[model samples]
Target chain A: MKILKQLKMTCKDTSPLISESMDGHISFGKRLRLKIHLTICKACQCYKNQLEIIKNLAKKIGSEDFSSKKNQTLRPEVKEKIKQSLNNI
Target chain B: MNDRQLDSSMWVDRYGDIMYRYTLLRVKNVDFAEEIVQNTFLAAIQAQANYAGRSAEKSWLFGILKHKIMDHFRSQKRFQSFNQSDSDDSSVDDYDDSGHWKIFPKDWGLDPEKAAENTELAHRLEECMSGLSEKFRQIFIMKEMDGIDSTQICNEFDIKPTNLWVILHRARNQLKLCLEAHWFQNKTSE
Candidate 1:
């Protein structure tokens, strides 16, 4: 039982998701170990919250318009010029 | 127009913004970014026969653009600005004061959902992002703002998975603390 417990903590240490503990890609044993750790660890719970915040902020930033009129103006001409230059080679 | 020029048009239409934006972020200069995009296309045209199509067409253009950015940096001796040479070795210590730390990230319990409706907080957050180091800002923009996956980002930046994770973790924590402090400071002042 003691050896099994050490093995569990070692798994948690190596796993990236032990903090935020993302789902989908983790192995069953590792996931169980992380779940056990999270049940006792307030720090890991805070880390999970932080990850959620980052993801939410990222989603908001993605919806905003980062493109400008100048960037839009350059597109067509740059495309035309690329084709023209390619054909000559 | 020549056949090569016509052939290049399809490629350009597909990848122009990607190449331009990638270059713009790396160089941080509009004219230089435009020049790099033009040169990348021109080089792609000349080397059109070499494209293997293994990667997506946009990725190919971006790969070329990356090279062009490097070449431009090399020629102008502004390579110092594009330096990620030291960034790889740098790790977050308990305290690395030489690189400013505005807020200590100790048990803030900051919740984004709570902050979501606050337009003032969003504006302040953007201001803080603008103030981050160029390396940190680019990584944050590419990974977080653009929603690129870690594997794709690793391929694009030529960094290892560990390094990529470090950048993402640090960028997230930094922004969180920054936003919390910004909001807290304003609240106290009010």
Candidate 2:
């Protein structure tokens, strides 16, 4: 019955499994079900691939290499205020 | 006073700009980001006793900064935002009643094996990320960008494992649709 349930999973059910698989491990049964669904479903496959792309770019965005070069930092006045406050302590 | 100011100013001189940029990237508000960094420095100074030998001062400062960032997310008004998202599966429309994609995602044509670095794509992705609600954005970045494990995140946020996955899924679905519409179909990257 459980195997039947896994086999009957729709894109709705399987999509989360697809996403969860990336975040961490899903059960072997769920992974098997996802594989079957993905093999048959082009959209689900696309969703999986696109997530990988998004993940790749997101890592760069979070890392210094992508963000630090934008030339943004603390304002001089703000720095002075922080320093003054720190000196008061 | 001179010794303490020297210590404080030295921290500001070295880590202030970097911490500001890091916070700004996540929070996307200059004032709020600066406030968070300022709090981080202040906290680090207070926590200096516990900090010794635990780690490098720079990492200790950044660690405190990360806590401050999470604290901002965990503030009083965050309950409303979290509750709203919990009640609504905003990506429900992305699929139909029968559980199929209402609009099939466009072929991004990226190689699944290799992630080619494209600043333009990164810039576009960052823009799309900002469109997400703050809670979703931070969790997504933590899991995907910061390499934090799902269990740790679940414990940290006090969310059910299911809720965490759902949040991540919604974020991915939304970001995908957004990038497809704004970047792929916009003819800039095409």
Candidate 3:
């Protein structure tokens, strides 16, 4: 019975779909499994859509370099120091 | 100097700043982030023999920096469970699980593009981040901002793959809800 519940859960959980949808790292098996789940479940579909949006928003944040100002300010001394340290070692 | 040390030094010179920036995004403290970057380079120097040259050196350093970030978080006692009142069922229940999805206009209701365009969204994200529980914040920043792979994150955090997924889901959900409540609700009211 516990195995049956586990099987049911393996059947019920839409994590594979959500994970693939978010990360774009879907495996062939996970893709087929997701198709099977989405064929029957509507909630997972909406969840997947929201997940995509969240993922895209995150991508936008990554594209924008919030650290550019700091990057530009790497003092020549620091660069020289790093170079010297690497040279000495 | 040994060839390994020479090659590692060259790699660090090329990629250290990028790694430092990645760590900074996750750790949110310059000094700590720099320390992690230093450790990542030091570890790379030590482990250069093990590097099979499978991935780009940048990716390899990133992999190490990621571990260092997680170590910093763990040492700071920031590794905590994501406790929420909403059960998993309730959290995901709002949407249909089927593949059919509607891509409605994502107003997020905040017009994050406008916020981002205004140059305040960065700080807004930072402020909103400060409100999160430390674990959620770290996980979100690492996965979302640093573009670290989930499997690598799981290995670093010493968490099961399942636990990593749940933490990521809850963190994203919490961040979305926080942004909506703090920044978007007023837009809707208008």
Candidate 4:
């Protein structure tokens, strides 16, 4: 049952499937296959999520605002202003 | 157990920095981060009745802050264009010859929330990213960060869909190894 064996998918085969699924490109069959693999594989699951967070954080870097004020804490005036408005509520 | 316990009093003073740190890590803009944090507070005040007070106060506030951040990202997604422009034509081999990882993924033992919170880990990610090839860096960002459609990327890069996935696999794998070496290694030692 070589066909059946291949259907099982390997960490290697499943790796690309993980990335492909993120782009909404993987087929239902492959998606199902990837899900099955992930159930048994912790590492691939870890890879799936780590890439996601990195992607989320990196999205900000790629945005136009990347060049603007970065990593600064809330200003005291803005803090004061928000506090006052909340108090008004 | 009521609205009084959920009072907005001292909210800005108490949760201000915590909210700012979380949003800044996600949005990476000081002004924007401040805006979202402010909105989060406002939203909390509006939804003040929803705080069941079963969860910790900080987490309850954090939950609202996350929703506000996601809403911002979703609205921002409309203008999300890559330099390539979209005709829409479209579009991790972390394994070895036999299709198994040469070495299994070493659990960094950090959950996504914890990993995202670690400022030092974020710096390591930036450094590891810098080490990827220019093409790897570009495609990874285009696919992962830019949220570009896979087929559209294929059309823009003039590469087959299969090749794009291969490139992503390598790029992700490389980042994994680099982070393991830089961040997790130190984490274990500590």
Every model's DockQ: 0.24, 0.57, 0.16, 0.28
Ranking by TM-score: 2, 3, 4, 1
Report the lDDT tens digits of candidate 3 across residue range A46-69.
445545555555555555245533
Give the CA lDDT, 0 to 100, for residue A14 in model 2. 77
Those runs of model 2 whose alpha carbons end farther than 4 Å from true positions after fitting are A1-9, A68-70, B1-8, B76-81, B84-90, B96-98, B149-152, B155-158, B187-190
Q: What TM-scores do the predictions have?
A: 0.51, 0.82, 0.53, 0.53
For residue A65, model 1's alpha carbon misses the true position, in angstroms, by: 2.9
How much does each candidate deviate from the true structure in C-alpha RMSD? 8.2, 4.2, 8.1, 9.3
Query: Considering every candidate listed, which one attains the maximal TM-score?
Result: 2
- Model 3: per-residue Cα lDDT over B90-185, one tens digit each: 345434464222332134533323444533445445556667766667677768876878887676666766676667776665665665577656
lDDT of model 2, residue B149? 78
Model 2 docking category: medium
Instruction: Please state the error at residue B87 of candidate 4 in Å.
Output: 22
lDDT of prediction 2: 0.78
- Give the fraction of reference interface contacts each candidate recovers: 0.26, 0.64, 0.11, 0.46
- Per-residue alpha-carbon lDDT of model 2 for B1-190, expressed as tens digits? 3322225558888888988988888778898998998898888777776755556566667778888887776673346345545635677676789888888876777875465377787788877888988778888888887777788877667788888888998898889878888888876454
TM-score of chain A of each: 0.54, 0.73, 0.50, 0.64
Docking class of 4: acceptable
Clashes of each: 9, 0, 12, 5
